[model samples]
Target: MNKTFKIYAVIFIIIMVILALLEVSKKEVTDWRKNFDVNEKSPFGLFVFNKEIKDLFKNNFTKIDVTPYDYYSEKNKKPHNILVVESEVDQESWNKILDEVSKGSDAMIIATRIPKNISDSIGFYNSKISFEEQNVLKLTDKKYQNDFIELDKFPSGRGFSYIKPNVQVLGKTVEKNNEDQANFIKATFGKGNIYVHCEPLFLTNYYLLKSGNVKYAQSIFSYLGDKETIWFVESNTKESSSLLRFILANPALKYAWWVFLGGIVLFIFFNVKRKQRIVPIIEPLKNTSADFVKSIGNLYLQEGDFHDMMAKKAQYFLNKVRLDLLIDTQNLDEEFSKKLQLKTGKSAELVNEAISLIKKAQDPYAGVMKEDLGRMNKLLDGILK
Candidate 1:
């Protein structure tokens, strides 16, 4: 390769090596799955609640883990309070929860967004809250008054607004002008109350594990009262493929696999070449008529047959006259000479002289000298010109 091309290739290889090394040396951060699964180790999971608030729940109520479908399937006579965190319930699940709540059982739903039917039925609408920085949350409820709870910067969640008359505002954010926007609301239906908290992230491990933030979550649980059984609904429903699950579970393997795939793609891209078939060469045909005639004349000269050579020369001359001048050669008399002279535009004397030489060569025993052949050749050359 040329010097410039070699340098470019070296630079490319170096860049690829650097990128591969960076990828290999990279460290994965905490998994932090955004779902509110109680079983997961992610920051948004309820593992912290199970660890810190389990004893508190044991003292006041029974904590049960089950799906909405399973909870509604049980026909027990016991009074149970439902708790859903960061989960979207289908229409059937919503109907089941509504039925349970309408039958004098309390329920608390903490999610970024509640179902539209539930929101409309509960007399509140939730909307996304955007802020330049993190906002602090505080309990506005008279019974569980606390200091401001500092949340993370750029919290990813929504907030609620009370639309129904007599709806109780349980909590509000302490950030500047956002104080009037309610984040938690309690609405009474037939005989029980439905507590809806927009900021479900408050109950996550990331916030609860933070110093003193656990009190903010505990304050919300105070509204649950003395219900016998508390059901914790699982919200993460999307199942990942086995390969993706494995990669996501192992950080080192994920990065290594990506680097390996990238290298393989680059190798194939540079190494690939186009293949073509070879073409053949061909030559034009050659005319050997003149060469053949010269060889025959040479053979006749070697044999000393002047009559045959002169006769062939006369016949060839007459054939040329017949073809080129379009004249009769059967009879080489004076009349024929006159006609040839007219067609060739030559003097009658020269035409008659050529005819006389041809007649002489036609004789069987005639012998032609080299000087006579030269004279005849000169005459034919002049006529051709």
Candidate 2:
């Protein structure tokens, strides 16, 4: 790998290590948002309350995932205390709850506000904004008149701004410096009672988390006697499941999938083989075999070895004659020259002279001269050309 690649890989590794350490060492912060989901464990959620609600009632306390309208639409002979916490009751649900209450089924709905239509019909109105962030409540009844519960961030939105004469005030906000404001009230229609509490945040985990504050909730829930209460909270009614949904439902699998995705991204980042520099153009070297042979010839000529050179040339020419002209060089005589003349299509004088030179060069004692070598070479070229 190149120097640049090595440096980048080191930086990438360092950054990854730092990120992993920070992720491991980071502290988990407390969530204070008012999400009233039954499964949420955050401070202002209903996880704790839902888990411990069964202790408040002695009879069968069933949890209905469906809305009150859907639950009450069917025939239920037994009396049940319907409990709905931290939710906006719709028109159909409100009407259905009223019908259920008229049929001797009690419903206690705790919410910051009720439907305006239902509020207008019953002459009960709750304010949408509360100037006070904290609240203290006092029960109006003579038996629990001195009972007071200190609360934080009370009237999540607002308290009861107006209450009808027929609806008896259950509890009111009391402050030494301010006048009392109606926070809780109950309206009796038929044989059952529909109690509306304006502060639903009081029943969340933040309040019940403290041992002392659990009583504040229990005191408020005391109105819901030991009867089978149907707790209706938001629920996912979806009947279909997707592959991705299944993976996300499991924490370990979800994190593993995310890690796999991250690995793909890192692999793509470091896969730099395709990002190389362009290659340089290079002309190929020319053929040098002919030049090498010319150099050897020049070396032999510089040595002035005419007799040896003549003998070497005679041997090579005779071999060529035997192979190409099909004339045997076993004897350099008149018959051989005559055959070569016919095969080579050369003059009789040229063929005869080359044969004579070959015969002279073959004799070692003949001492072939340079002139003889030149004339023989010319004669051989003329015969072969």
TM-score of each: 0.54, 0.61
Tens digit per residue, CA lDDT, model 2, 1-385: 8787678668766766676677668898988787787877888888888888878665468887777788778856566688888775678988988887788878887877677888766569755555676777667777665556667653453567778889888887765556777778888868888888777776787777865666666677788656778887766622237888889778567766766776677678768456778889999897799899999999989999898888998998988888888888897778887888788888887777788888888888897778999999888877777
Global lDDT of each candidate: 0.72, 0.77
The total number of steric clashes, by the backbone 3 Å criterion, in model 2 comes to: 0
| Residue-level lDDT for 119 in candidate 2 | 75
Q: Which regions in candidate 1 have their CA more than 4 angstroms from the true location?
A: 1-24, 30-33, 59-66, 177-179, 235-385
Return the TM-score for candidate 2, rounded to 2 decimals.
0.61
> What's each prediction's clash count?
0, 0
The sequence of per-residue lDDT tens digits that candidate 1 reaches over residues 111-216 is 7777777799988875657673677777886666764577664465356644677688888765654555677888887777888888777777788777878777
What is the lDDT, from 0 to 100, of the residue 223 in candidate 1? 85
Worst 10 residues of 2 by lDDT: 232-241
